[model samples]
Target: ALTWWNSHVRIVGNDAADVMTWIELKKKMADTYCPRNEMKKIESEFWNLEVQEESDRVERYIGGLPDSIHGSVTASKPKTMQEATEMTTGLMDKKICTYAERQAANKRKFEDTSRNNQGQQQPPKRQDVAREYAAGSGSRPLCPKCNFNHDGPCTPRCYKCNKIGHLSHDCRSPTNANVAKNLRGNGAGQKVTCYKCGAQGHFK
Candidate 1:
């Protein structure tokens, strides 16, 4: 820059030098380094530039850039290519962070849903089943045959005859001890089996 200034700017006459300004200096430099014909040729090349090959480099990088990055950079209206690249990098980082957060949230939701389904699928306890059968009685249901809070089949005891393996209403024994005593005194052997001793002609 000093060599060009000394050779081109310093040699002007006193009257011509008086009229020279910074803008005039810049225009002279532009005219010398970038001629009108060369500028036109560069413009033409920029318009014709394509990314047909993987290793192409254009003077205007934005012209050959992919739409995804180019559109974003253009929307931000960056004044320079460096600013556009920085914006692109920041956008990608923000996108990655949001995706990671969403993935973590989805994973947590899936785990919670799985736990709920497992709890729902568990079999009910025996006492819980009995309570449900009780129909809001707030207690376990009683077995009709045994009249007790139990589940499944059972050998019932007779309330009337004081014997096991049968219900009171189905007992075949005499109704009371007095009836058996009267039958015995009259010598009437009814051939009934005793539930206690398994012997005939007696009742227990």
Candidate 2:
């Protein structure tokens, strides 16, 4: 192989000397030593070669790209390997800008959500405040017998025993006549007195 290469270089002496770069040297060597059929086979393989994991060619190109810049790279429709590489190199600034813009938008959204939540935390309503104040401040005194808060006159009557102090459910006494009387407190036999005029049969 060495004898053949020397003889070939001698036959093409001036052409070999003209090889100024690595690329030119490689091209000259391939043209001289490589068979025409082998070159054609290698060219076929080079064009058809693909990444095993990635099925789509475009996806293979942009697979390593950040999501924010993927769309722009794919939209340019680069036709050659060199063109695609050039496009990616040219978009470095745009990729960074897009990523920073997305992060800024997310931060703004979080701040707005926090602001809205803070705004929604309103003061208590008038009725609720008044109810709490009345209960807490001893404005309406609690009945000592039943522990009931009352604004007017009230009797601690038990439904089960027709007596004072405990409610019907909490009455200690067994079932008796008073239990039946308490059940009939609002029955037809009882008088319906009007509080406004001290009258019966109709409400004031």
Candidate 3:
């Protein structure tokens, strides 16, 4: 079975040295695989050889470029193989830059809107001042007669003199001297007692 497989193995290369190298490597692999574990190792090596061939094909398609372009094709850099190819070839950088700029502008707009909303939601200092003024004015003392503050006009009346514009405490009305005489004359028909001398002629 090994001899048939070796006979059927095909190599495509114009270089005689390369063809001889492949033949020798294949012969060594077949000779080294005597046990099942060694056979598994050989299979793994064949798989590795196939992967290397595919990698070489991809590298040939990408072509030889500068280190900068080569770095862009790495798995850690581009999002996909196609994107890596496009970036390496300078086909999509402009579009990517424009999209990034638009995204940044949108982010800035969102931040500005959030800031304005916060400012509008907060109460203003002038409103707080007005509220404090109203509360202070409501708590101040008012005049008893006019129900106004002290700054308002005075319109109080004096109860003793029955006069407007002055309180009873500051009244200047004089006492009437004819009050007793008028009372005696009005009570002429009645007997009034004089409490000073215990006589029944006039009231004290």
lDDT tens digits, residue span 1-204, model 1: 668766765688657866889899889888878899999999999999775633232225555556656677667766665676678788778878999999999999999999999888878898787556565543656667644665667778776567778886677775544445555675555466565555565666
* C-alpha lDDT (0 to 100) for residue 16 of candidate 1: 83
Query: What is the per-residue lDDT of model 3 for residues 110-162, given as tens digits with 9 covering 90 to 100?
Result: 99999999878866697687556655676566666544445557788765445
What ranking of all candidate models by TM-score puts the best one first? 2, 1, 3
Name the TM-score of candidate 1: 0.30
List, in order, the clash count of every candidate structure: 0, 0, 0
TM for every model, in the order presented, reads: 0.30, 0.31, 0.25
Q: What local distance difference test score does each model get?
A: 0.69, 0.68, 0.59
Worst 10 residues of 1 by lDDT: 53-62
Best by lDDT: 1
Q: Which model is ahead, 1 or 3, in terms of lDDT? A: 1
Candidate 2: regions farther than 4 A off: 1-80, 90-96, 116-121, 138-140, 143-204
Candidate 3 global lDDT: 0.59
